[model samples]
Target chain A: MNGVNIGVLAVQGDVAENVLATQMALEDLGIIGTVNEVKTPEQISDIDGLIIPGGESTVIGTLSMVNGALKKIKEKIANGMPVFGICAGMILLSKKAKDRVVGEMDQPLLDFLDVKIERNAFGRQQDSFESEISLEKIGISKFPGVFIRAPSIIESGKNVEVLSKFNEKIVAVKQGNIVGTSFHPELTGDLSLHKYFVNLVKTKH
Target chain B: MIPLAGDLNDAKGIIKENIGSFGTKRGTSTLKRGFAHMLKNGVVMDVTTVEQAQIAEDAGSVAVMVLDKLPSDVRKAGGVARTASIRIIQEIMDSVTIPVMAKCRIGHVYEAMVLQETNVDMIDESEVLTPADETRHVWKWDFTTPFVNGARNLGEALRRIEEGAAMIRTKGEPGTGNVAEAVIHIKNVNNELRRIKSIYDDGDHQDLISIARDLKVSYTLVEQTASLGRLPVVNFAAGGISTPADAAYLMKLGCDGIFVGSGIFKSDDAKERAQAIVLATTFWEDPNKVKEAQKMIDERQSMLGLDTKNLELRMQERGSTA
Candidate 1:
């Protein structure tokens, strides 16, 4: 494939690291692409794919909306633009997010993926831990998953394929062109998830 | 007061004409001016909603902070950035006229740039929550946008100011919710400034720079820049500033203003507390005003569960890593 432009949403999240991870992932697949930071709605249109890094969901959602990228993002996704949302990004992509201890606090969600998430299901920051999960269903073996006050998929639609699970909770899921992960694959130094997303982007293109 | 506008303007013109005659450096005057402004009008607000920003405007805060959630929430959420949603920021901007600010991860300049384009008055380069890139501190000098960064001490504060920051703030170390750390930083900076002043008379810009370099502090750049005739813009104190007294105390210590995250809304009487903080910062030196402010603060104040010592230890740990 020709050089693709991959953008990492720079709206109040882990932008640079995601860019680096994506760059690495693309390189592993022998793909040529320019990984740039996309902050505004205008910049989003230029990218072939988008990565929403793990961050605080509320801030990311608020910032994206404020920057006028939310609607644009929905449009792009609807038009078959591949999007990978990690952690809080996953929360934003979900149809609903239950605020674990707080319960029922309404947060603005993107509702792209037909899934319900339990926000902060892993407890607090100190409760953050790592685990190896089988992505064999997606044709991968063991992958390290970094869960930091992570969200868990409580429900998924029939179309949503479970890619990985931990402790009976759906940690990774894919629905059509939209991909969501409750754990941070980017932080774990794993490129398979990113590689898979790139393949999705290539196929869609 | 006499109409000193003429004299001030004359002095400004002379200073401008002889910018080279002063033969100083870049950041001295700028830091001084910023420090002075913060002393005069400092107001901190709890920015949970657009409505809260209006309250901040009504109370006459110099700047408004947009948070998706409060410091307490950040702690509970494991250092997540939950401030005003982008929609909420739009609402808040529509509601108020003062400078609107938001927090993002350190080194997340892309977010800062986005906020800048959204017409946010400023961006707080603070670790109010966990940084998106937890491994590094965000450097603000790289962007064209004006930023106000949080500093744990005078050195850190001065460094950000030197790095093209329009403003500087003392980090209050949230979660613990105590102003003791802010107090210490203020005292340390003040003492350091006094020492710097005593060592050099006027026009000893080189000496000042050397001292700052030797100390490996940021204020050295402030001294160099100020000597070159740049005026400091603004400096504020943030983090554990909960009450009007706390706000007043920082103002007295030479902070330009105060930013209260969980301090205002976390209390039972948020409005009253917010009002009192406004009063305290505006009339910081008045004993009677202080007394009244204290009464209002006392009425609304609750025990903050912050362990200052533990936070200090964490700062030390983080600093070492940084």
Candidate 2:
């Protein structure tokens, strides 16, 4: 690949850290890519890959809709742009999301992934925890999973590949050009997950 | 199915026991600092009612500060303004998932204790509230809950850090709808930091000792701050942030985030203004983004203006030695 252009949705949640991680991932893999925040339709169209960070799903969803980024993102993802979504980002990417504590929510979502997940499945904010998850498909053995008010994948379509699990509860999934995770990879200092995503973007590009 | 596992059940049990267990010294300084870190480049709106707090949460505020009255109102209605009623604070807490912070007088340790017992996520030893002691502040090192204080210069910031304040904000004239004081205070801190950093680079720990004595903080902390060229804890900009432009200006000036006090709810279109401020704070570097945020609100509906010079009380001057 000549070069890759990556973007992180700036609608909400840990935007800078995602940018930093992606930059580090590029350096580690010896790849050249410019990572920037995508908030407008122009910014959206200018990226080869995108990452939706973990934050309040409802807020991010609503703001994206209001700002006209939601439609552009959905169109790009459907056109096979490799996208990574973490936590609330995962919820936004999933086709269906039901809250464990509050039941189903009516919030806007991208609905690009063929998975059904539960928001805050691990528990509340204070119930968040960190643990090791082994992802075989990514060629990584043990990865640190930081669950902060995270979601859980309860069901996945046949095309979706389960990447990792926590106590048999699905925490990661991938389908072709899209990847979603219930835990935050950016929060952890490890860069393998981002490196993997960058490689995915590289292959797709 | 994956498999039946007893270890998973034990993990669930531990979570169940630890849920809502914040009062028993279970929260460490690291945890508090981590929580505050999550609020960087975000907006924390000041709210007095559950309804306002709901608006704030809907507007994407990282947190809400529970207060009894708008700071301007507290200034207008000359009386002893104290901590907000726990009943109101509890109602607001129940209404929002974002952290709820309440203010106590500058030295009212008992009020802070009560707030901690109520399990508020954080406490503010605010000078905006009526001071319980003119010469002292709460020793926040004793509390599990983190405390945030106001500072006008490096000395005030270091002193508060020494007293265990996990965060600091410039004491701009609260409720004035003016951003000048915040601008001055932040610039003062930044200039002082640059001076300290230059001294440190010159290999002079001696100047830091005198600066520490002047700040009434430990010499080690001063040295560390000088070496880092920033406060150890997060420093947010607060007071008189009435517009998206104001929020963006402070963020560009190098404050960690913004605290909009009475600037959202007291203005017309609270929801729109609140959301606009959040957007500006998040994209402070982009002038076009800030312009878009500014166009989101109608300026004619802003809170009634106050000239900071005319205010009988300078809230920012309460504890300042500069």
Candidate 3:
């Protein structure tokens, strides 16, 4: 493989960790790629793949929406460019998201993944936990799943493929080129999932 | 901030080594620190009531820090400020979907415990309240809930990180509606961070060790911070951020986020101001967008600004042994 250009949506915070993780994932896969923090609409159109990291979903969406990057991202992902959305990212990709505590919210979302999400399904920050979980489909076992005020998939459409779950809740799902996880793989330092996404990007690129 | 590849690896190594042994699996450092990361690039507003919490949520604040009174009011009242009433905190928590945070007097562990019991999302070992223990801070490692501590410099930041804080914010003089102190604090922290980064790059282990000694933090933490060229946790700007431009300026200066207290509710158009600040914070890199945000709120409605030099109380100086 020659290389791939990867972009982490850099509208808000919690993005650096994803960039570092993807960078390592590429290096580990023996693939040469440039991982860039991208915020503009032009940058969005240029990436081979994109990762929307965990942060405040409202903030990321609003910022991305303002710069017209959200429109470009939706186009890119819809056109089969690979994307991995984690935690808040997972919410952004979902078609619908309602807060467990506050009921419905009006935050912006990409509405591409064909799933309904419940934000903060695991309660608030103190309830945030780290657990060993299985992502056997990706060839990893006992993966450290870090759920931080995480979301959960409440409903899945016909095309959604459930990848992983915790406590009987849908936590990770995929539909064609787009992958979404309610837990943060970037925070866990386990590169397998990231490597999986990088390879997804490579194959698609 | 993006760090060197080695620094990221070192952090990962640290996370891998220390995760499962932290008293229980439910609330490890990884979980705590990661919680803070989730709040990056957002605004956290201080709220005194459920109404304010709702306003903050509607305005797109990532979290709301419940307070018994606004910091300016606390300072004006001239009494020992303590943790907010648990009832009020619970009320605010129930009213909003966003994470709820509350401030405890610096070094008030039991207060933190009560907030944790109330199931608040995070706690601030804030200097905004009067310090219950002037020379010490709550040993935050014992709590399942994460802590965000205020720091004026790198040593204080690393020390808080050493004490198990998941986030760090500038201890700008709270209630003053002044952004100058926050600016100075972040500048100082960044300056010291760069100094250490240079030392680490030069491979001057002895100086790193001595500098670590001077900072009163663990040498390992100093090494990791130097290697990372930034604080290991998210750093937000706080205290006196009163307008969209104030928030945007701090975001431009490299704060991961902004914490607004009196800035919002104290202003004439609290809801509009809150929303504008959130917009400015998210789009700080684009001046045109920031201008759009600034235009959302009237400057005449902003809080009366304060000068740090003339303030009777420098809250940033409180509860610091460093």
Off by over 4 Å in 1: A1-205, B1-40, B82-84, B133-139, B202-210, B215-233, B297-303, B311-322
Clashes of each: 31, 0, 0
Residue range A1-205, candidate 1, lDDT tens digits: 5688888886544555688888888899998778898866789988889998865576566546744788888888888899999887888888887866556646567888888888777654323455567788778797876665678988888999999877678889988888888876765567888899888877776
TM-scores for all predictions: 0.50, 0.82, 0.92
Candidate 1 vs candidate 2, DockQ winner: 2
User: What is the C-alpha lDDT profile of model 3 across B1-322, one tens digit per residue?
Assistant: 2221212222211222233332225566677777788788899999998888888987889899999889999888987888898989988877787788999888887888888888898999888888888778887877778889999888898888887788899988899988888899999999998999999999999999999899898888899889888888889999889989999999988999999989999999999898899989887888998899999989888888777797788788996674
* Top DockQ prediction, candidate number: 3
- Cα displacement (angstroms), candidate 1, residue A52, comes to 48
* Model number with the top lDDT: 3
True-vs-predicted CA distance for residue A177, candidate 1, Å:
69
- What is the lDDT for A163 in model 1? 90
Those runs of model 2 whose alpha carbons end farther than 4 Å from true positions after fitting are A97-104, A115-145, A149-171, B1-30, B107-110, B132-146, B162-164, B201-203, B282-296, B319-322
DockQ for each model: 0.01, 0.21, 0.55
Off by over 4 Å in 3: B1-24
- In model 3, the clashing pairs are none
Candidate 2, CAPRI quality class derived from DockQ: incorrect
Q: Give a tens-digit lDDT track for model 1, residues B273-292.
A: 77777767656766677678
Cα displacement (angstroms), candidate 3, residue B317, comes to 1.5
TM-score-superior candidate, 1 or 3: 3
User: What would the per-residue lDDT of candidate 2 be over residues A86-179, giving only the tens digit for each residue?
Assistant: 8878888989988774577777889888999987786544445656678998898988767665789988999999998877788999998899
